[model samples]
Target: MRVPANRRTPLHEIAHARAGDKGDTSTLSVFPYRDEHYPDLVRELTAGAVRRHLGDRVRGEVVRHELPNLCALLFVCRQSLDGGVTTSLALDAHGKGLSSILLSLEIEVGEIEVSPSSPPR
Candidate 1:
């Protein structure tokens, strides 16, 4: 079904995410549920946009890598781990939960057909 024009929806509704971290950088990969949504993801999920959405959680730069063949976007976030897994005092020292936070970000889907088969978070 088509969602309203300019309507905001949490990214989880359209995509799924996976995240991993090494040292101070976190790598997040987001895949849209439908391949047709790739361009929309590319347009909306910019490096600056992710950095702004993450706020102080990401102290360094956010770089986005596009994988058009996979219909995915990979975000490399620097200085986000509070140091590293061993050094950070944060509860989620590995930054595993960052994907959840990333999914919570709202995007304007306009009139796209959101798949009802979107998996649960």
Candidate 2:
């Protein structure tokens, strides 16, 4: 997940992801490689950001739930399972690929100003 020399890098470099699904709802959990990055990661990985990243693949709403104690972000993407594994014709109806796709999102590297909501490192 290491990106070229630049001011930005893929989120995967700083975090890892896990995904789960039930019916047409999919949840993606983003855990930071270090808790120090948790706040910035949360600010960057909003519901809207995930929604935009997924584009038309997500027909319904995208919601993000924060878990500060765990230094993780949980994204709930609705209507994202291609109508659930049982109905979808696609082989990956479970939406496992969505987790990897989330990891592909870019985040600022080098130095980034911490937001007021961010916790101390």
Task: Provide TM-scores for the models.
Answer: 0.89, 0.83
Model 2: what TM-score?
A: 0.83
lDDT of 2 by residue, 1-121 (tens): 2233336678876789999999999999999866767877876888998999888878999989999999899999999988899999977899999999988988775453344575434
For residue 121, give model 2's deviation from the true position in Å: 14
State model 1's lDDT: 0.89
What TM value does model 1 have? 0.89
Q: Write the per-residue lDDT of candidate 1 for residues 4-46, one digit (tens) a residue.
A: 7677888887899999999999999999887877777998999
Query: Model 2: residues >4 Å from true position, as ranges?
Result: 1-6, 110-121
Q: Which candidate is the best by lDDT?
A: 1
Q: What C-alpha lDDT values do all the predictions have?
A: 0.89, 0.83
Candidate 2 residue pairs in backbone clash: none
